[model samples]
Target: MKNKILVLGSLTLLSASLLVMNSCNSLPKGLKTIQDFDKNKYLGSWYEIARLDFVFEKNLNNTTAEYSLNEDGSIKVVNRGYNFIKNKYVASTGKVKFAGDSNEGKLKVSFFGPFYSGYNIIALDSDYKYALVAGESLKYLWLLSREKTMPNNIKETYLKTAKDLGYNTSELIWVKHN
Candidate 1:
């Protein structure tokens, strides 16, 4: 009967959904939020220590991001980098706005048209020496610094932190600078 066919179709769709989730293709495991992100001290230059090899900065060196508060209560985000392979300097400007009162550190940034994406300040050092950023998902984590280089111990600690948040540290692409 029609009811029997409908039931079988629903079961098949449910099994397919479970199969896709088990594959782990899109959504990833990652941290939820930063305990307390100091807005004042965190607004400054931050070098890209490790990234997910995103297209915006592929083969780029001396990658750095600068954040400043705008007059309109928005965060001015500027990402600059030198492309070693292309022998060029690239700069992309964007705007970041806070989510709401309940989501202080959670933010939305727009770089490619009207589509805004999550940019959360997951972890930060007391002195702002290092920071862990989550770009909406586990596959979009980044280790940043005020300087071009990070200490070995610091790198280890950061990797561990990222791992604890359900991220795979081995997938991180270490960005080398000139």
Candidate 2:
């Protein structure tokens, strides 16, 4: 009877996890992603100018992310950052694939196998030099650029865009670069 109960509990947990994963594909009301995104143009290195303080990347600086196309059509994601407190460089390699169609800018990225998080390109400059990325909810947001520091005008615009999307722009932690 104990074994049966354990099995039932495991199945229930698995179902809930699957449900959450599926729900990540849809953005909450009032949030939208860019249209006609070109993955090839976006492939390259990006510096994280600002971000929310998530556990995986808390207290990090000089953060950068590189993207390249894998032979199998998936995107290879390499993230590097300097942990000031640890006095070391931290890195994580992952894979990203479009959530629905490549043109939509909605992506699913996985650092740990089979477990993906949302990577929605909510905003992008016309030249593709800067971008704003969002995750499954308002708690996750990132401002990225080809350079370490973005212009004040651009930064204000992106912050405003995020604010309009229900994110708390004041909570953004600017990443320092050496």
Candidate 3:
């Protein structure tokens, strides 16, 4: 009876762990990752043109992210930004792996060990010059471009798309490249 009870407890714990891990890859309702995503083409530097204000990026300007292939088949994510208030540069390194199909832009990224968050590329241009990324929920969104500045047309279109998807576009903080 003791052995049976122990086995049951272990199984229960394993089930719960799997559930938590899977939830980290979930996308927000009505949001979708781009199909036919070419990871190789997407792996490069991107400037943060706009984003919804978040604690990790608070008071940050001139932000950028770089991605490279890691030896372990994961993507290395390096984010750098200038903290105007702190008068210093800040950076964070993380890892990203495809959440499901490699052809899809659905990924899970983790800066902290054993905890992952959704990184869904909701929109991307054919040339890979601009991308609109959404997080696990409506509260997280980013407008990324290969250059420091995005074209006005692209910006307006992305904003409209975000708004259509129930995002609060007004809450976005336009990041300064300088």
Candidate 4:
């Protein structure tokens, strides 16, 4: 009986430790979240100007993301897009929490329960009109803007930055807002 109780306690402790470790995820190597990121300013809506082809967003166009504060202080994410091939609209809701410090742009977003992925904001304009976001690896990158269209200069600059970070900028798919 005592041996069984000890084993249970050990398992409980190990489970708790794993939970803690998962909650404290870090950004991918060679990527850094922006400093002094204000979540409040980042809230509201953003248009997906460009992105690398990812399964969740494949064949999607006219994509936009809405962010709001959840009751538990996590960011509520609503991603909506039009599937041109399917001729239908699709959306997925998720939650985002700071991976580390709240002031940094490093966050983990989960659409599936208890399974989080990195959402690191690598760059942003002072007015929060445009942002460059990186996922867990070079495979996932997004260029977002407050409006449907992004400026030429900003697009060029962000593409250069992504390329510098070892991303294949040529593979980027420019999202159509119409």
Candidate 5:
């Protein structure tokens, strides 16, 4: 009687958790999973050229990301930036795990939540000169580079890739380097 009731309650909780997880992120038809990203080339510093303007990083500039391999085989994503509004540098650390096709350059990242979001690498330079990132939707896009700015051709190519991925490139805020 009591055990049966407890079992039923546990099952209900698990079912609810799964539903919540699925509802967290709305992915596109061919959205890449954790298995898509390349870990070796993915590591290093990537400058933020544009983004969808999350409130946390709003009014921020000189944004950069430093990634490293953690002890547990997870990638440590450390995003640092200088917020003009807050008048201070902010750092956000999050863990990233691979899903779907690891070699295909697609991954899902979570920032301390059960809900993992898309972090796909749609374009990258051979010399690692620049990288174009597309998040879960048409709004989440970023262009990064080793230097503060990139060449016109590279930038154009990246922008076109973002647009093809269903992002509105016009909204990309040109990051002002400090």
Candidate 6:
């Protein structure tokens, strides 16, 4: 009887996990991601151009994210920034993996163990020099570039896309680079 209960509980837990993970895939209609994303070409450093304020990144500047391939086939994520409030630099390391078997643009990133969040590359430049990323919702969005800054035209283009996707573009905090 005990063994039967244990197996049943295990199956319940697995079902719940799947439900929670699927919830993170809720995206607005007409919001499309880049196609044929090459993970290898995207492995590098990206400067944060703009983002919506979040606790982990609040009061930060000169923010950057670096991605590299791990031997285990996961992506190593390194996020760094200067904390003006703390008057120091802060960095966090994380891991990322594709959410689907063959979709390189949709990823799940985890900083705290076993707690994953969506990391979708909704828009990207052909040369992989610029990208617009979104989380599970419109509340989590970021604009990234290979350089410290991006051209006005590119910024406007991304902003328009975000606006079209029902995001509040005015709430984006433009990141400062030093």
Candidate 3, residues 63-169, lDDT tens digits: the string is 99999999988999999999999999999999999998999999989888767888999999999999999999898999999999999999999999999999999
Ranking by lDDT: 3, 4, 2, 6, 1, 5
Which model scores highest in lDDT?
3
List the candidate 3 regions with Cα displacement exceeding 4 Å.
Answer: 1-22
- Deviation of model 1 at 106, angstroms: 1.5
The stretch of ten residues in a row with the least summed lDDT in candidate 2 is 21-30
* Model 6 score (lDDT): 0.89
Q: TM-score per candidate, in order?
A: 0.77, 0.95, 0.88, 0.86, 0.80, 0.86
Q: Which window of ten consecutive residues has the lowest lDDT sum in model 6?
A: 21-30
Candidate 1 TM-score, true structure as reference: 0.77
Better of 1 and 3 by lDDT: 3
Q: Evaluate model 4: give its lDDT.
A: 0.92
Candidate RMSDs in order: 7.0, 1.3, 3.8, 4.4, 4.5, 3.9
Q: Lowest summed-lDDT stretch of 10 residues in model 4? A: 20-29
**Local accuracy of candidate 2 as per-residue lDDT tens digits, 14-112:** 999977865558674687888999999999999999998899898799999999999999999999998988989999999999987889889989988
What is candidate 5's lDDT per residue for 1-178, written digit by digit as tens? 9999999999999999877654524455454433334687778988887777877678899999998999998788999999888799999888777644557656667776666777777777666668777776676778888888888999998787667666778888889897
Give stretches of model 5 more than 4 Å off.
1-37
Candidate lDDT scores, in order, read 0.77, 0.91, 0.93, 0.92, 0.76, 0.89
Task: Report the lDDT of model 3 for residue 61.
Answer: 99
Cα-based lDDT at residue 125, candidate 4: 97
Q: Which stretches of candidate 2 lie over 4 Å from their true place?
A: none
lDDT for model 5: 0.76
